[model samples]
Target: MPFASQPVRRVAAAEGIRASGHWPHTIPAVRQLLTDGLDLDPGVTFLVGENGAGKSTLVEAIAIAFGMSPEGGSTGARLTTRESESPLSRDLTLTRGAGSARWGFFLRAETMHGYYTYLEQNPGMRPDPQFHELSHGEGFLELLRSRFDSPGLYCLDEPESALSFSSSLALVGVLNELTAGGAQVLCATHSPVVCSLPGAAILEVGEWGIRRTTWEDLELVQNWKAYLQTPERYLRHVL
Candidate 1:
């Protein structure tokens, strides 16, 4: 498939703007994206890193630039409980594919409760899922199963936060379904189980910036393997 056929082919800083000694631009991955554009794959792309590494920042900017709400939801959604989103979206530019679907969704884990309430307040033609009644993990899975059936750009920020091991696997399955239907997925995650999606592009985000890597070679996976092999070895430091 042609690169332009995907929802978003590339991401870079807007013309005439330079990465400064600012909040988000100080993030190495964001700086790299601004200096040298990052090309997105046609299918699933996973961003993995530690906390405060700007994975969520990049994902949020991409989603906002693609017209999704800062909180979470579809393109038309306007849910906002607070004004805490970074100012990176305004300075970022998304190079969308030539004939890709403009329809997209942003699944922000932190503000999903607000998004659910927003859905209830503004009922659509279709019946909204009872997101409140379900448990946290169940709600995430249900939302993925129901809302993620469409073909478009789906940016998920730390979706595994509310998911268990089995649910994480199920999330990967839903991602597979989306990719099969020509939809694209950009996810920032920490779960080794979640990022282990076969053939999914894995980008390590950190002080070194974003670098394309493999599942076996990922620091997250290696650390998980080490910790699992001997929990005491890792627990000793923080126990």
Candidate 2:
């Protein structure tokens, strides 16, 4: 479990985007992130944002820049369908720590089915029970147990998309273990459960750009708290 104190220290957008005329510039959040470099925690860094806030865009770009597949899998798993990745990976610079990662995976909830198919086709790469054969949440847990056995970097996008509340809590536990084992995790999520991991660095993304914040300060967390406190108050309108 012993590893370097930090794997990836920071990620910064290189200058010359204006001249490069890349598509990332078109997205306001991306432009803002490019302007202000992002500092990563050695353990866990959670990227929290509303839809279209560019969290996924930034996470995917980081995964690609770190040499992982865009479709979401291990670096060895070269799975791709169509090229929808932004050029941001090519422009961004990743600063590593004293040591390099020995293992890593990029898990995008939306494309996990594709990753499972790839694994099924390649039995050697497939874990026991087969990823596709298991339920969505089960597959994610299995990946965490098996693929994340070593100290490495992990990038995840909305991993709680298919998970229930209990399952999200289970993931939080797994993440706690992973970080304790010296893994660095970058997750883009809307799940309050996933964001509530103690001591995790939370970066809130919005039209105003990204800023370091706490779980209590996040609008998503605040709304969830209010709704949970008085579901009747909000549900009355919807119902």
Candidate 3:
């Protein structure tokens, strides 16, 4: 993969918005991040947060701001199945490093089924073996291997939704290769496996606001570690 254009360097909400009634403004993480802005890692930037922490909202906004479909697929992918996207994209400002991104894709776990269906209906867009034919994890991997061959920006939301532990590890490799090939990846995920990429920037979203953090410091990783160390402690209570 060669550089078609420079990757996105930063993303922030445009200044001077009335925050009284906005949906994003009401979300603590979104509000703080929008005001403070985020400087992305040229290689990889991972967004880690608990459920309802606005991770998906932020990632979706970035994808839309970059002109990718609010659903899933590359900028050229025009398959629109619904109009459920938030209005945050309209208020975002993206700063480019030097060149422009020639290729980009937005991959969201929830809407992948619909995206695959769209491809099936449009034969020209359908890949070999058809995306729907494969298992969820397999289909996602195939898409990454085949469609993500070029260097560009990729925004993914909860990509681990369907991936098994092994598949998530494989994704780590795919993402590592993409970054090394001049691509930039911004992902929102809960899987420790996916977020374990070496040298990547990890940002934790919470009530305190978006700030730089380490993989070890992430609450998700901490909880996972605790569980792995003693599953019976949690299972005892839940079961």
Candidate 4:
């Protein structure tokens, strides 16, 4: 059945993050991180930032408030959370445009060995060749190719966790095709290729908060590419 047509959900987070003070009290660069909420089209929206910039905090709050799970992580393990049975459940004064929204996550699965034990719980539901049964990169692609569905919002945190260069490009193509068909995708990633999914809106989290940036302007991508293309100049001094 086709999903019900609903008013697209709007996340209006300009700054000021708190969970009644459950999370780390001091969120660095809070204002600079999300000075304005990006209007996520009915397509891919990529969140890019350095470590400890509060990107995950924003997404985790949304997931919790909506009673949805962040895609990755194990059942027993813990992410920063308040005392709650479902970490993905919370009460926030959200100013939403209006709509029925659901959330899921696309965290990179752990190492192959860990993934095997993880998958052992889902014998029937596991992907072919199995997630644990394939190389880290292949397993990730297969899981995405098989499991990701449409007409819902999905959050992926740094999916470049396992992909090689070739697979990374392929993953980009897949994200493009998914959002073009009317689904909403919100991803937190450092991969330039993953972040540049054509129509994706790039949000950079820094000392202030979250600001919209063009795909070409991200310094990490530029520098990383430069290093990869010519390593000797950068590496010669270190060695």
Among these predicted structures, which one has the highest TM-score?
1
Stretches of candidate 4 exceeding 4 Å from the true structure: 1-8, 12-25, 28-39, 70-106, 110-129
Each candidate's lDDT (Cα)?
0.93, 0.84, 0.85, 0.59
Q: Scored by Cα lDDT, where does model 4 land?
A: 0.59
Candidate 1 lDDT over residue span 4-24, tens digit each: 689999898999989999998
What is every candidate's alpha-carbon RMSD to the true fold? 1.1, 2.9, 2.9, 5.5
Q: Note the clash tally of each candidate.
A: 0, 0, 1, 13
Worst 10 residues of 1 by lDDT: 1-10
Cα shift from native, residue 49, model 3 (Å): 0.8
Clashing pairs in 3: 6-99
- How much is the lDDT of residue 205 in candidate 2? 86
Q: Find the 10 residues in a row with the least total lDDT in model 4.
A: 80-89
Model 4 residue 108 lDDT? 39
- After best superposition, candidate 1 residue 117: deviation in angstroms? 0.5
